[model samples]
Target: MADEHRNEHAAPHHITPLTTYIFVFVARAAGTLLTWFASTVDLGWMNTPIALVIATTKAALVILTWVVVIGSFVWLGVLFVLTFADYLTRFWAIY
Candidate 1:
């Protein structure tokens, strides 16, 4: 029974809108490369914003790709909200 179920589900269940996935991968890869490039530059104030943007983009891609809980859209929404809140709070002095 377990083997039967496995066989049924193992047939390459791909997500739709393949373009979106491609874009996500490209953005994440670009962000990673930018982060690496930024590390070698001595821009002082500019570094924080660059790093934050890269980190936020990478985090978003990860959440979208791997953390989609089954029947738990609310949780995903909350995670997104929290992630955005963190991103916003990082670059500025928030009271």
Candidate 2:
């Protein structure tokens, strides 16, 4: 029985090609460049979200796994919610 499940633990995975790695690296580099460009141009309320999206994409590429992708979105959502939550509390006067 253990041997039957052994293959499940050590399942054969797809091997990644060098060119595929190079492409992902290029994509990550492009994401960084786009982030810089976005920073330079003021997009008003649109800047943070766009930057977060680019950063998350780059982060996802670092591992290129579904777990990383899901985690990235969760991370993004946390940051976005916290930022807006703080933004929403900037006007209190109860001293």
Candidate 3:
């Protein structure tokens, strides 16, 4: 009777498959390698955008796998808006 009572109070067990873990790890590694490779080449104006895209992809993977807070995207959106605003306000394109 005591065993049955203890069992009733026990938390449920969850098992994540090894394959899923392996896949995420491999993908993260590939992303890192690609970022390094991108740095070695000279694409002039395209470099910054390429790096940002790769970094955002890696951040998405990490957020999806670990972070539970959905509200964090609000900050990210704010940052993007401010960055673009600053970018647009620059007058360095003067003739």
- Tell me the tens digit of each residue's lDDT in model 1 across 14-87: 66587877888898888888999999999989999989988987987867775655546687678989999988
Looking at model 3, residue 80 earns an lDDT score of 91
| C-alpha-based local distance difference test score of model 1 | 0.80
TM-score of 3: 0.57
Tens digits of lDDT, candidate 2, 1-95: 65664655575767677887788889988999999999999999999999999997887776563344677779878999999998888776753
Candidate 1 lDDT at 14 equals 62
lDDT of 3 by residue, 1-95 (tens): 65655667678866667886787788889998998999999999999999999988988887886655567777777999999998889897783
Model 1 TM: 0.46
lDDT of each: 0.80, 0.82, 0.83
Question: Please, what is the TM-score per model?
Answer: 0.46, 0.54, 0.57
Model 3 worst lDDT run, 10 consecutive residues: 1-10
Greater lDDT among 2 and 3 belongs to: 3
Q: Evaluate model 2: give its TM-score.
A: 0.54
Give the residue spans of candidate 2 off by over 4 A. Answer: 1-10, 63-95
